[model samples]
Target: MPSLRIACFHLNQLGDLVFSLPALLALGRGFPKAQIISVARPPHRELLLLSGLVHNVVERPRGQLISKLKMVSALRSMKLDLAVLFSTSLGTAILAWMAHPREKAGFGKRGLAYRAEKIGPPSVANNLRLVEALGCRVEKRDYVGLVKLDESVRCRVRDLLMHAGIGESTPYAVISPAASGRRAIKEWTSEGFAAVAERLADDLDLVPVLVGTEADEVVAGLSEKIVDLRGKTSIIELAALLEGAHVFVGIDSGVMHLAAAVGTPVAALFGPTDPAITGPMGEGHKIVQSDVPCLACMKTSCREPLCMQRITPDAVIESVAMCVSEEKNV
Candidate 1:
């Protein structure tokens, strides 16, 4: 009631965190006077701080009992009125309960122990249900673009583009071929990407730029003409680069989400993952996927990744070309 203090737990990867931005924004808007504290993984600190969705970013210690206790104790010390568990993990649910906030909300049965209502919705809209439960005004946001790029960052990105021989007016397409180690099945083949790169150059007359960490080196040889910016830019820099591009072509990776968040037309290639849920949301985004019945199996490891192999380069090229053409018309 008086000067509300809230703690929201989201100890997830970059893409999942991005998906929660809409709900976070709605929550912040509902309680302008409230201190929105975000407890997330250490890697998410930059985004959580830059997003302006939360006032504070607290790191959730990885697999440490004492550290977990300290985290929950710290929240309890703040006299939090509400604790929203954006994460579905049992650990996070227990932490929220331990914090003993006046109101607790999350999805699943474990969360129901702390709060009577179980938050329901897709990933993006899940936390909004928690905010609405507390009688907060939640607006329907079209896109949950949380990051705001600074003018200085934009200038730096421009300099990088110039260095890469990409002109100010040059229309380019950004491609990311990297995925986490465990999700290698989600990545399309290197040969497929090379074919797409050549198509972009010959058919679209647009330069192809690769974005990712040095881990992307595996796909670096996909095409020689591609400008490899892997391991060269920070996360924010990658976002800036993707923001300026006309089209983004990538797997369902965090970089893809970054590009989509910046409103770039994305031709996302979905293989082992489900496009309906994890696919890029909002307008101007197309999912090029194989018609494999087991396509969305969500398997981390596979002896034969037929789902990814089924997604041909021609299909991805067509999707990217269509997206690029649509952008030009706009």
Candidate 2:
């Protein structure tokens, strides 16, 4: 549309950035000459850099109103032609309005001042599926695939694999045991992940690469056999590592979404969250959840987490085995 400059606002968590990759791809294809700019958290800047579709990344600081005002001023300088707010936050819509883009699009029940197109009811599933609902005339809608890595990051991942004693020819599965939130109800136990990893290692001969941020180190400590790569790799490097892995097994976390974005087959464990809404969007994703009445409550704390406790290690092991076998056959 005459070399339009587009700005996409997704200042949420790391997984949110990953999930929005498909929409970014669609924008790139739909407007080939458009200069795509992404405004997101600092931690996700690397991800935006790795995504070849983005022309620039505007980092939004989580701080006072003065800081946000400064960011808004910076966005104003960009002179964006179109803005897409992928997040459901009012702040994002406000930022888009502050940018003064020609056209703004977002999803919310209430109307936003600058948002020209508003998709009804902001749900997790609808948010992820917005590439289609937004009604952008594109050939494909299911573009939520893995993000590409820069050459430098690819080289770093290769070196990391070599340093870990994992040969290029060796097969491996990635296990991410930690979720982002502090809610114990949402997370499966560390012992369950350990058991799955051990079984996968023993039966399938697939080495398990444990991945997460620094906060997940304690969970990583639970597994002695796994190659503890927590807090060791950057966002781009993690994408490269996930791209090479045969499969990914993890709880409902950002890494799980990252794995799905990377186009890796995933077997995810779900507890207090609804898989139908937040599960990985892909063909090869297999979600395991228990039938507990209190499940999908999205509660932060609970004395009893039957939803997660019922998801035994044996079930995960079996799922892993099935995924491994299917991959081999492919």
Best by TM-score: 1
Local accuracy of candidate 2 as per-residue lDDT tens digits, 130-207: 544545444544435547666788789889998998888889999887766654567777778888878778888988
Clashes of 1: 0
Supply candidate 2's per-residue lDDT for 139.
52
Mind giving the per-residue lDDT tens digits that candidate 1 earns over 163-203? Answer: 98998999888988878776888888877887888888889
Tell me each candidate's TM-score.
Answer: 0.87, 0.86
Q: Least accurate stretch of 10 residues (summed lDDT) in model 1?
A: 113-122
The TM-score between candidate 2 and the true structure equals 0.86
How close to the true structure is residue 310 of candidate 1, measured as C-alpha lDDT? 89
In model 2, where do residues sit more than 4 Å from their true spots? 64-67, 109-135, 143-146, 182-184, 297-301
